[model samples]
Target: MHYSFSKDFFWGAATSATQSEGRVEGDRKGENIWDYASKEYNHRFFDGVTTEQTSRFYEDYQEDIQKMADLSFNSFRTSISWSRLIPDGVGEVNPEAVVFYNQMLDELNAKGIQPFINLYHFDMPMKLQEIGGFENREVIQAYKKYAETCFELFGDKVAYWFTFNEPMIPAEAGYLHDRHYPYVVDFKRAAQVLHHIVLCHCEAIKSFREGGYSGKIGIIMDVIPVYPRSQHPADLYAAEMADLFYTKSLNDVILKGFYPEEIGEILRKYDQLPVVTTADKELLSATKIDLLGINYYRPRRVKARESVPNPEGVFSPEWFYDNYEMPGRRMNTSRGIEIYPKGLYDIAKKIQNEYGNIDWFVSENGIGIQDEEQYLQDDMVQDDYRIEFLEEHLSWLHQAMEEGSNCLGYHMWTFVDCWSWINAFKNRYGFYRMNLETGEKTVKKSGLWFKDVIENQGFDKNN
Candidate 1:
């Protein structure tokens, strides 16, 4: 292998409970926000496909996990459903859910696969939603209880724990962009929600420490490095401000245990500062994480605003900068995201230089291909584009590692083609493609190629 990794480097893929495990209303599982939202507002999801039509991992976990082992995965990252564990989100633990999860963990251990478990991935319980979701302090406390329960239950079996996945998505998509559930376009509520989510993460870390679990705990963030469209001073300033609001807002809090002063200033200027207490500060300070998970799919390109925003308009991140589409940049037409592999290297260097070179990993990175069936050849899907995508990103990651970044591992966005929020199955992003109608899974060309890469510990660039 021309690009050999460390002997202990993690080689695996990632998935979330809401996106994979499809027994939504079964096994005494309480309705989550996704369940309620998709059903009530069916128009949001493509083809009106609800969460219940996901990969059916609840029933086929054994088979799916076996496939992972066969594919030479040494590690895997998945989230525990908050509603599945505690059906009501705060009361009693579900017995069947416990059995299922325990069995799943045991199976992974049996296959010599390390399981990295996350607590939340945008699946808020409906009961909690009724109480204003993460915007309410009471909901934060409820999340604390939920975190403690998880530690008490599964801490022994699972060593790697993450408090949440892409914590900012809920605030940005749900509150600001109206793309997620409980859709509202209010910047003040978005700020409050973002603050409470950070506190909730801190509360989980505090619980983990107090519980004395011998494992690592952290949070997964979607880190999109912001690049200025040009060297012009205005463009540079716009990029800096965009980075502060979009990336550093969550990262600074998790890795440094404090919000950036500029972020606070921006929030205060808009009268959108979240209500912060002295106790919240102390808790955040005392519970910094032991690891970091970065999910990088693309870079954010920004330029100076072409025109002034209306003073009467509601506050939004775009008020200061405008998105710039660089000419001749590679594009993922299927997903409408610019394909920039160097973003991973840029993020790694930034974390190394700015954030104390903390222990971290590439948690979620992959391309989503629409109409993937068109590439099917015989029994396998010839996903050469996906393979090329991974190769380029991994090359950049290897370069970052050579420069002494403390990146520990790399896991792609998913193990199998599964349901996506709003998009549903419109875009396929798995090594194994699942037929939505029959629940049949077949290994794509990328899956076969990834097995060789994992077994050899790396890939040959000359290939």
Candidate 2:
């Protein structure tokens, strides 16, 4: 069977500035939370690896862009670091960072790869964090001003713009899970941060429209299609609650301009609702995203909580549902995650049927392997498993496209195995293998396979 796509389809990958570009504190770049975290809390990172080490897109973007072109990529997505652009979080625009981004975008266009730019990717400035970050309404206005400054500087050089990538992660990881920076254990703060981030996104979109930029603006969402452990009503309701709280709380407002009433009810019951004003309601109702980027790596298998959560504890999403590893489920042990290709199709149908069939693309999806060096053979990784993983997921994506999905293209999680935050280089998720010691790069077998897929504009699994 042959699966084909349009010529304009984006056949590339997505990465973030902090994860790929080194020189964290150089060139007058402001310190982001990650930078501060790396210094203050080095014990959290794998092998004590910090953000100072990366694939070095800052110094090697020209070479890296050439390699992107060599991979037959039609489009590539990366974020502009907020701290690097505005060292103090507001007011001054770093001239050095401005020159670097301009050159990078120009180089990408020169190679004929459409640049998909995202403004924020969980890399909040340390200055903003000191001033209460998203918990403060003033920071939202500051973000909007930073966005407007981006428009003023490089609006003409770029076409596709995104306000934030997975805005909920900061709220969840930072405030609730104690995983990301500013690690706290307050569900109320999580809800407030989540709502404020959405408000920030609305303001950025408003800025884009008011500035009259011809380019498009949207958000890259991490859509984890959740499943129930059984057909029981309690399990089914658990799945729905998980979806509403984890996925739709932010998604609905961005795409549909309002929260599901049930979310309000659930939060209100626990005294966890965020502050929302009358004017904020008008802002959210007016600014809908132009397009969307769906990032799918796995699904969340949830079940009804077995034991009642302590009523005295502060409210969290997990109080309603419990995640269980259903026995005999297939797993991606390299990343310690479940492998369910059907979730991509299910996510597509959701956008097509519910979200007015808005323009969208697979902004990030890939398999990450621990200690990928074991697969190295003759100077390149013979990652047949990656090829198989891609074929399975893309087959479902193709089926969705044939069923009238408005998906534009598919981008893998990344092109280079960048510095993946606290995970560092422990998980390799890149097409081209990079040697951290020598700064060398070599295309893996999967890269060659994908190049042929893009060259032919399709794949024939039968072969």
Q: How accurate is candidate 1 locally (lDDT)?
A: 0.92
- Candidate with the greatest lDDT versus the true structure: 1
Per residue, candidate 1 scores C-alpha lDDT tens digits across 207-299 of 898888998999999999999999999999999999999888888888888889998998887788878889888877777889999999999
TM-score, candidate number 1: 0.98
- Candidate 2 stretches with Cα past 4 Å from truth are 24-26
Per-candidate count of clashing residue pairs (backbone under 3 Å)? 0, 0
Give each model's whole-structure lDDT.
0.92, 0.91
Regions of candidate 1 where Cα sits further than 4 Å from its true position: 24-26
Model 2 accuracy (lDDT, Cα) = 0.91
